[model samples]
Target: MPVRRRRSTALAAAVATATTLGATALAALGGATTASAAEAPLADYELTWGIKQSYRTYVGMFGSFTASEGAGQAPGSGAFTFTDGTGTYDTTAHTVDLAFRGRLVSASAAHHFEVTLTDLRFDSGAGEITADVTTVDTSGATPTKKGDDVPLAKVAVTRTMTDMATTLTTEAGEYLGSDGYAGAAGDPLTVVKKTPPTTEPTTGPTPGPTGEPTTGEPSKEPTTDPEPTDPQTTPATREPSPTASTSAAPSAPATTAPATTAPTKGEIADGTLGWGVKESFRAYVVGTVAKGRVTVSGGATQSAGNGAFTFKDATGTYDTDADKLTATFKGAVNFKGHESGGSYGLDLTLSNLKATLDGGTGTLSADVNSLGTQTKGVVLADLEAKSGDLKAAQDVVTVDDVAATLTAAGAKAFGDFYRAGTALDTVDLSVALSDDARLPDGGGSDTSGGTSGGSGTAGGSTGGGTGTAGGTGSTVGGTGTTTGGSLGGGSLASTGSDIPGPALGAAAGAAVVVGAGAVYAARRRRTQGRSAE
Candidate 1:
């Protein structure tokens, strides 16, 4: 009996120890999880800089110096003052964003004084900054521009936080302050952390104009509508200027400029259209261009009849009142072919283009049937020769408004092409047309009656009869027209047509592969559109 009691006690002690250890581990794990769910403390930072310089040019001599500093993303705040051989400039009194920089231009009284920022950089943890700034002077006796590559100011910055610190050193470079800046050729800046940003509620909005509400929500109170006034003459409802007299007339309500009037039908100048095209292309390039991925060049059109010619880039002009945009684009987009070889171009000619931005921003689109060149070198030829009608969706301009013109069904189709993140829909290219292309006899293809048909060969006669592929006398569809013709009993729109004909020609097999790609792209785009909806 005694032996049994001793064994029992030993077992109970072992169980008790195991239970304690398990409970301790569970508690520790719970504490870790809770700590992880807590928010991290925010870090605040600031930067300060200054500059001074005097120089002579063919025009005259100029001199100036400026100082500025800015607070960093939330929680940190401070000011930097600059004074040296250069004049004193303290931007601490002025508003500073997350960056500390300033722009100094020729003082109104001094024509020679101008500044530029050439090069600026910061090391890791010094906010990891790298930027090159230039000048933007809208008015004044514009100073002759010097090379922007000159280093105007250089600085070494050290950022020290309670838990961590970093120092950044930069090479001396030009100060291209055309944009505005105050800093020396080289300087040292020290930044220290202070109080953290608070989570307190921000102050409420200040009163805008007399009678205007100062609350977050629009007032439910009934109000009388102000009489319409000339947009150009309408004064903005701003806080009364400091110099305002005690007896001021009622303030005008804030309002947007009236929508622009649309161009008269068929009245848009080619130049206006060209400008719009250039703007659209520039916008696309800005958003899409990247190294080793895509490149674009020579978007302008030159003179015609030269064996190698290109059509002019399209132009666009907005009609605010009409809430419509008129534009035209004609050019070639080249696609990189297989790794081994083979590359080609898609020659496009768009005219008489009008679009309604009614779909709002990014919905300014156009759908138009395209005419295909019978020329051997063009990729559109392969598709056109196979499909009776070539379809095109070109979103020309993006603006905010209501789309009212559904009649321009073609334009609506191009809306998706213009929408954001559709750069891949565009084929990037580089080319210089040796000569200009002749405008089509009637606007680069016709879209007269239904069952559209046009014709072309090296010099083939125009007529109204369907001919087998490659067979002379085949009638081609006019631009922007849909035809009901099919090849090999397959719907021309379907991917099953494997028949070889003049359209495919010597490159029939290759055309099949390329045409299939075009079809796939079109289908994928449509799918994406549906999914978005």
Candidate 2:
């Protein structure tokens, strides 16, 4: 009984030790996981930024006319200044304030212009931020001949502030990096204002009385010139004139005309240059040459007729050629492979072309082809063709090699023939031809040689021996002799040639045995008896 109790106690102690060790190990693992999480770097952070910029413009016009000649309308100088207040920029929304003022620099003309902003929000990020000044306040003096001020048709300026956090890193525990923060030069705060059209009051002429004429001459003269009244009123009191009483009749209430509101500022729509058209103006998302279809709303206009206007996928099209184009998008423009959200320019071309999202700027050239003496030009220069069976993002169809093929005289050509004109100029004119000409196979052998040899049997055997003879005799010997060779004048011997002695004897013995076997046997027996005696 005592030994059993001791064994039980030892087992219990072992279990307790194991339990304690496991708890310690589990606690250590938990601590390690927590440390790793705390030490891990932050992926990214969101920030609100603001920017304020000032710009000055100088325009010069030259012609054959001078101030005295008065040939040009406004051949003088003009100056303008623009100021944009700070705006908020976060992942969600972007807002800013824009203002402008312009004055005629030359004395020949007097000019004045002003544009104010109430609230500008860029949610879709499709088009750029711009200002347009239509009516100039020429309330002051007008310009003479050469010094006339030229009214500005419109002024457009685009600005973009990017989220630097994508390229920046922050401490493990820090909320955001230092470079993540952005502010304007003066740290100016945004001011929101209500901008409504100004109302004008209408004026009316005064009347003499309800029924009296308000014309050039008075309707009635003073009934009597005060009957030659003395300098002082006879009664020390004068009655109020009828005309004065009539003028007091609530001078007709001024009527104000309803104010006409101008169109909203910086309103733009989101658009796309559908599918493969993004890289090249070659085809639509359906693999057909883009028919140059462009649809725009929110007061937008096409800039150029050629390649400038195109569709990418089904979203919308941008007419970069249009000046001062604006559109209001119903939804945000989504791009493939990019997480950041904003309107991006589809300014892609064939070579060195880049698609810029986040409201970036880039330039593209036009592609031109020559036919005889005429040149056909493609407005969209940077066009690319995709090979293989990879579909484009945004539900854009893949363009096959056949659909993108261009002939030598087509508007655009690719591959070796694209530059054939230059090659033709430097080509050699002299060369010789052969009747049985053949190209060397890649293995460095004349393939034509094998074809020239007609079908025939191989003479040599696989074991390096000659083939069988025609008859049932032995095969022709290695020494070029037949099996049934001659002893002296046999069938196989050459005329006048000596036969070999050993070969000749063997043949003669074989022939004699066949002709006289019995006779030879009798003779041999007799010879044996004689020898025995």
Candidate 3:
């Protein structure tokens, strides 16, 4: 009995020491948990943005568009919604990296475009949202793909998640294969952040591994402490529960987009156009045959050394999708010679030239004054510029001597000086685009690569540009309902759509599993403990 009493005393002393030390360790561990909770990882995100409005409106005319990976527009709404978003937010850095699912396709008469957007990276310091973009243009006949992981747009975002307005970058314009896309506005964005979920602290006094009941009151000495193998030592396994830390787990932060600077309607404020009516016509007017001279007025100036005519203060629109240009210039040129008795055999003047490009043809219209007979909007020449014949650079589209044929009306305008369908001068033309404007062809012109009444289709990612003259919307999903597309998209829902989200609940669950594992270990140690004899 004495020996047993000695053992009991030693065990009790050891238990006392362990209880004190475990309390200290618990205090320290609780602090550690609190620190961990403050730095929670991002578990999920919901981001919303439309690519661009006018672009959508133009493409929507091609009928509704289909979506991929379950991304689609809200019913009857122009905004798009993406669910199950996945990404991370860095609290200290105030940055976010995210990715969503969705692919959109649009087409006009003779052209098709496919765009997929993902991997959005937001930097608060830089105040930009950069996304990886991939696109395919079918106008090249082979469905050329470009802009793989391109920096497509600039976005505004900060830690507070305000002002998610977006606009396309010049790179996006290049990705879309048109300068008119630069600085195009998109829908304002919104964010819904998901936090890392913590395991709830178990209720009541944590059950001891030993099946004994505990007093229902808090105390310095725990009845749950097990017998120490040595009086000088406490149980090596004693530790605090993860409950305190998990409960304080923080949530993911919000995301925002930046702003844009441009004319609201994306219209041209000022521009210029350079074109020469015809090389042969100009020479003939100055040659000994007609014995005539050419004169210019009204903002029209001849280039130095008898170059092309340069007309200033141009006003018009450029269509990127259709690769069409509609512009009217301020200028006039007159050719007069062959004077007779109160009559000049050759007298011609062309003014206010208007240029229109539709499908594969370019038309030059002008106000003609032939010997006192005035005519307006006369189709003076038909220009056929082949692909690779025109060069575009930094807001300038250039054509070097494209083939131009005189039209029937043009012959009469010249007092029948030349017959209808006569070979006119090779045409030289150049026009500049304005940085302050965006021309998305919202009822601007019908110059799609296909003829006015030709058949075309909006194609799908796989393939679809086939059907009637108005064409069908290319699609892979049935969610596409034709509410806003220009042509027929039999399977897509076109409501001025936006982007979607990704799934990331697994992140929060992972941390929870870690905390639960620690609790399980504590219980297991207690369960395997042997009672003091």
Question: Whose TM-score is greatest here?
Answer: 3
* Each model's backbone clash number: 58, 21, 26
Instruction: Give lDDT per model, in order.
Output: 0.23, 0.20, 0.44
Q: Which prediction has the highest lDDT against the true structure?
A: 3
Report how far off residue 109 is in candidate 2 (Å). 20
Candidate 1 residue-wise lDDT, 26-134, digit = tens:
3563533422332121123333332211111100111122333221211100122211111110111111112223332322112222333322222221233333334
Off by over 4 Å in 2: 1-101, 104-271, 274-308, 313-361, 370-533
lDDT of 2 by residue, 265-310 (tens): 2221222221122211111110101111222222211222111222
* Poorest 10 consecutive residues by lDDT, candidate 2: 54-63
Candidate 3: lDDT of 268?
39
* Model 3, C-alpha of 309: deviation from truth (Å): 1.8
lDDT of 2 at 484: 42
RMSD of each: 28.6, 48.2, 31.9
Better of 1 and 2 by TM-score: 1
For each candidate, give its TM-score against the true structure.
Answer: 0.21, 0.13, 0.31
Q: For candidate 3, give the lDDT.
A: 0.44
